[model samples]
Target: MIPHQWYIVLESREIKPGQIVGVTRFGERLVFWRTTEGELVCLRDKCIHRGASLAIGKHHGDEIACPFHGFRYDKTGKVTLIPANGKSSEVASYFHIKRYPVREKLGWVFVWWGESEPTHEPVYFDNVDESFSWSSSRHLWPVHYSRAIENQLDLVHLPFVHTNTIGRGKKTLVNGPVQVVRDGNIAFWVYNEVDHGQKPKKAEDLPPPDFSRQHIHFIFPNMWQNYILDKMRVLVAFVPVDESHTLIYLRVAQKFVRLPLLRKLVDFLALRFSQVVLHQDERVVITQIPIATQLHMEEKLIPGDLPIITYRQMRERLKNV
Candidate 1:
C-alpha cells in the first residue's frame, strides 16, 4: 500500500457511540470505535498483552474492556485499569495498543497510512459535503486494490468493455487525454471524444481544455472522483482489505435537485446507473493475470494509457512520501 496518505476504509454509520467495529484494511486488522461524544478512534486490533483481539471485547460506558482480562482502555488506547492488579491500580505507561490517526468525513472514515503524525486532512471533492445529496454502496472485489483503481483510470477499454453504455461513441482512439497533477496528490485528465481515423495526438501536443465539462481526478493512496458537472459526480474509495481483496465504496453525489423526496430519487437513480458501469469494469479487471499492478509491470503500454501511466508513477513516489 502507498504510504503517508489517508485511505477511506469505512463509512461513518458503520460504528455507533456504543459499538466497536473491526475489519481488515491495508492488510492489517484494525478496530474502530467512538467516544461517548462521537469522536472516532482506531487501533491495531491486537491487544499488546497476549495478543487478544480487542474487537471482541466489550465497550463499556467510556472504555474498551478486554474480554480476555477485563483490562480497560480509553479512546487513546492507553490502559486505565488492569483487572488483574485490582480496579484501582495505576496502569503502566507501556500498557497501550497502537493507535492510528482517524477521521470521519464526507460519509466515510479515513485512516492515516503511516507511522508518523498526519500533516493534512483527508482530500475531499471540491463542493461535496452536506450541501449535496448522495447514495452509497460497497462491493467486494476479489482482486488487489491497485487493479480496481486502474480499472477506473483506464481509458482504452471503454469501447470494448462498455460499448452499449458510457462507451457507445466507439472512441477507441485515445487522444492527448492531457493530464494535470497538483499538490503532488491530485491528478485530473480530460478526453471524451470519438476517434475519426485521425492520428492521435500526444499529450504535449494538446491545447488547453475546459475542465468543468467532465473531470476525472485521483488522490494518492486510495480515492478518485469523476466530476460530471457542477452538482453531480461519482466518487470511489478503493479500500485495501488485503493484497488479494478490496472493498470499493461508491457514492453518487448531486445537488441539482434539492427538494426532499426529489433529491433522494435522483441520488438513487444515479447510484444505480453507476453500479452498472462499475460491474462492467469489474468483470475484466478480476481476470487479469496478476491481481495487483506494479510500477514496472511487464506489459506494453501506449499513449492511450497516459492517465494510468501517471497514476503508476505517482503511486511509486507517494510510497516514499
Candidate 2:
C-alpha cells in the first residue's frame, strides 16, 4: 500500500446510521459506524482494555461501548465513559485507540492509511455528474491488490483471455497502446490489430491517439475508469484485504437512459456483462506465480507491457515518497 494516499474502503450505502460495521482492510481490523446524524467514523477494532473487539459492543448515541468492560468511546477513539472507573471519574488523555481519517466522495468511503495527517481529499474522475446512474458488483480475488490492478492495465491479454467476449477480433498485434502519465495518474489509448507477420511499432513511434476519443484512465491509490463514451463508463476499485486477497468493486455508470425503469435494466445488464469480462481476467490472474508484483521482477517483460511497467515504476516511487 502507498504510505500517504487515500484508499477506497466501502460504498456509502454499506454503513447505516447507528450500526457498527467491522471489516478488515489494508491487513488491519477496522470498525466503522455512523452517528445519528449520519457522520462516518473509523477506529481500530481492538480495545485498549482486555483487547476486546469493540465492534461487537453496543452503541450509545454517537459513542460506542466495549462489550467486555463497558468502556464507551467517542468518534476520536477517546474514552468518554469508563464504567470500571466511576461515571464522574476523569479518563486520561492518553487512553484512546487509533482513529483513521475518512472522506466520502462519489458514493464511496475513503480512509487515510498513513501516519501523517492527510492534506487533500481523494481524487475522483471529472465530468461524471449526478445525471449518471450506476450499478455495482464485488468479487474477491485470491491475489495481492497490485496484481489485480496490473491485470486491468494489461493490453495484450484481451485477445487470449477474453477471446469470445471483448476480444473476438483476435487482435494479436499491439501498436503503442499509448500511455500518458500526469500527477500520478495514467490514461491509456489502445491501437491493436490482427497480426500479419509485420513488426509492431514502438509506443513513441506511433502518432498521438485522438484525445477526444474514449480511453482508459487510472488514478493513484486504487481507482480505474473505462471511459467508453461521454455518457457511459466502467469504474473499478481494487481494495486491499490482506497480503493474499483483494476485493474488486466494479461499477457501470451510464446516463443514456433516463427513465427510471429502463435505467435500472441498462445498469443491470451492463454490470452483468462487465462481471463476465472481469471473471475471465480473474481465472488467469490468480495463477500468477507470486500473489504480488514488484517494480523489478525476475520475469522478462515485452514492449506491449509498457502500461504495467509504468505502473510498477510509479508505485515504487510513491512507496518511498
Which one is best on lDDT? Answer: 2
Measured by C-alpha RMSD in angstroms, how accurate is candidate 2? 1.1
lDDT of 2 by residue, 173-213 (tens): 99997889998788898888899998898877887855567
Residue-level lDDT of model 1, residues 1-321, one tens digit each, is 887788899999889778889899988999988887888999899888787888999988777887898888888889888888996788899999889999888778999988789999987765577887889999999999989998888888988999988888787887787778776544555564676768877777776655676768887778888889888889999999999999999999888998889888888899999999999998999899799987898989987787788888888877756
Candidate 1 Cα RMSD after full superposition onto the native fold (Å) = 1.6
What TM-score against the true fold does each predicted structure earn?
Answer: 0.95, 0.98
Computed on alpha carbons, the lDDT of every model, listed in order, comes to 0.85, 0.91
